[model samples]
Target: MGNARTFILMAVMTALLMGLGAMAGGSQGAILALMVAGAGNIWAWWNSDKMVLRQQGAVELSRANAPDLFDLTAALAQRAGLPMPRLYLLETDQPNAFATGRDPQNAAVAVTRGLVAAMSRDELAGVIAHELAHIRHRDTLMMTVTATMAGAIAMLGNMMMFTGGRDNRGGALGGILAMILAPLAAGLVQMAISRAREYEADRLAAEITGQPQALASALARIAQMAGRTVNIPAEKNPASAAMFIINPLHALRMDALFSTHPPTEERINRLMAMRA
Candidate 1:
């Protein structure tokens, strides 16, 4: 069901982009929009992991350097029937984690300093399992594409505004409307996709670790700590904020439109129900 929703949402985003283009510059504009979105997806697919890691100042960690983390990750990967993904450590006090890569073979997982210190062995296993679930289901790729399309749509809207949609049917009013609403629409679509996958990831993580309760506890703990502590890197790159296990942003005024993750309480409740 989640997969189906992701597919539908992605299709909607693409259609929205094409519609924006048509409004801004007729049939030619629609073609250009498609080209731009395609290029953006290609770039994001190959480099988003590196870009995100770099943005967060993440450092690669080997088994030799991070014995416990490496061992745990390896064990989890074995359970998931996936290759041992690369591990990274971020220098932050926020308790959060995220997975990246275009596919399972190229996948990587990163956890913050605070996450390592905050969780117990069992809780940590559940968290790792959650990230591994993302890799296994290829949610990472879906998210990357969604983000790229959303960004492209926003850029197209900006173009319309600046150019006054001189070639468009609706002219200045259309440009103004697109400028105001395109990003918001993109964000809504993107967030919808993100929210859909998160529930499935949570369920799969519970199955992988056989410890739904542990993950629930970890989620609650992470949420608590995240609210109190500042995640500097996430703050700097708010666009990447949706990648984390928890919403790490401090200001969440536009959560309805911008929140990438589902509600923590609801997520925890679902996991708890799974145990029952």
Candidate 2:
């Protein structure tokens, strides 16, 4: 059901982009929009990991220096029947983690310094399993694609902004609608996809680790700490905020339309309900 919903939402978002394009320039405009989105998605597919990590100043980890972290991730990846993903350490105080890469074979996982110090071994396993689930289901790639479309929509909206007052006909009204409504609609879809995938990742993580309560605990702890501990990199690069296990931005309000994560309390409750 989640996958179907995601597919439908993506189709709707694409149609929204093309509709806006047709409104602005006609059939040729719609074709132009698609080609642009395709190009962005393809470029992102190959470089999202590198770009995100570089933006966050992530340092690569290995068995030589971070044996415990590396080995735990390797064991979890093995249990999940995935290749051993490259590990990274984020130089931040927020207890958070995220997965990246086009697929499991090329994927990487990164954890904040606070996360390594805060979580118990079982909790850490739960977190690693959650990210592995994301890789397993290819959510990383799916999100990159969605984000590309969302960005394209926002870009169209911005272009309409500068051109809105140029005419007194329907062109002006179309520009008004595009400038205001199009970006709003794109943001809504991005939030929906991100929230749904997080739930699915949590559920799969629980199954893989056989430790729902541990994940629940980790979620609760992360939520508690996220507000007090600042993630400098995430604050500087707010777009990457959605990639983290929790909402890493300390200052942003958690609205459904804008927040990438569902309520942490709700997530914990769902995980606790899965206890057996």
Per-prediction CA RMSD (Å): 2.0, 2.5
Count of residue pairs whose backbone atoms collide, per candidate: 0, 0
- After aligning candidate 2 to the native by TM-score, how far in Å is the CA of 238 from where it should be? 3.1
lDDT of each: 0.87, 0.83
Across 55-166, the per-residue lDDT of candidate 1 in tens digits comes to 9999999989999999999999999999999999999999999998889999999999999999999999999999999999988877767767777887888888777774
User: Number of the top candidate by TM-score?
Assistant: 1
Model 1 ranges off by over 4 Å = 1-9, 167-173
TM accuracy, model 2: 0.89
- Candidate 1 weakest ten by summed lDDT: 1-10
